[model samples]
Target: MGEHWIDVLPVFSDYWINGEVFTCQVDPTAQAQVSPWWQVPQRLIDQLLKTDPGPVIAQALQQLQETRADLYGRFSPALLEMKIRHLLVQSHGQREGLMARIVTTLESE
Candidate 1:
């Protein structure tokens, strides 16, 4: 189910960050074989964008899933954490230092 990254946004086509890695962060410039299937909801996005520190993944993802299963979908919190870590490591473009640390947080036991 995983393969090389796609560097170009297909014209007039639908794509998803969960299914593809955009190497440039905003666009594609290189390649990685995986994508994180979940993203922070708006509330969490705002929290994560803060400079000091982001919300704890162990706590946050669970809350998101439990409260809004219809939006984020049902996913394993631990696996989601691992997926995000893999994506960030493979294609973070050296600009997501805060996020790297944030995602590296331990998953819930």
Candidate 2:
């Protein structure tokens, strides 16, 4: 079968920026081998940070947990949990960094 491709752009809070198109190749039989198609833009991150981050973080955590459950028996659950915990910690640090940047920007004005 021929490969199928779809283009996508990241959107934040109903706003979308132009000029960025991510092409994702879809292979019906090779779901596990498919790679991520796009990078999260810095502007999108900034816009998300400007709003309440709780729902976003909660959604991401739910997805991570679901993925871990889906991949059960393929790897050690303890190891996967450890990695997920680390990622959550990193997300917290990212929030702090974003807040710091906002404060700095405000102070400079």
Candidate 3:
């Protein structure tokens, strides 16, 4: 299956699936669709948040650099990169909002 971005946090009442794109408590089956990223195994998300994301990004960049030889002629590199970066920015904002809700929930707990 492919991935799509979801902008909302799925508490007991709301959530996301890997393929579908909506947030509602209306479906009893909604819980099944929650993404693995959001479910976050054994609640490691709390521990992960304590660390900076900088090193993660750096490692990703390094990996991409190392794989550059294998990535030649994949697409219109310039246009694809621009579009992907723009989309990533938009997704990042959406993720930020979702995280805010999650953090609020965690704090209140």
TM-score of each: 0.24, 0.26, 0.24
Can you write out model 3's per-residue Cα lDDT over 1-109, one digit (the tens) per residue? Answer: 1233343344454444567455544566545555644544544643453343443334333444455433323434454344334433455523334333433333343
Which TM-score value belongs to model 1? 0.24
TM match of model 2 to true structure: 0.26
lDDT of 2 by residue, 22-74 (tens): 44445556434334665679887876655655544455445545643444334
* Comparing 1 and 2 on TM-score, the stronger one: 2
> Which model is ahead, 2 or 3, in terms of lDDT?
2
Report the number of clashing residue pairs per model. 0, 0, 1
Alpha-carbon shift of residue 19 in model 1 (angstroms)? 49
Residue ranges of candidate 2 with Cα displaced over 4 Å: 1-5, 9-33, 56-93, 96-109
Cα-based lDDT at residue 80, candidate 3: 34
Candidate 1 C-alpha lDDT tens digits along 62-94? 554665554335356667666544544455322
Off by over 4 Å in 1: 1-68, 93-109
| lDDT ranking of the models | 2, 1, 3
Task: Give, for candidate 3, the lowest lDDT window spanning 10 residues.
Answer: 1-10
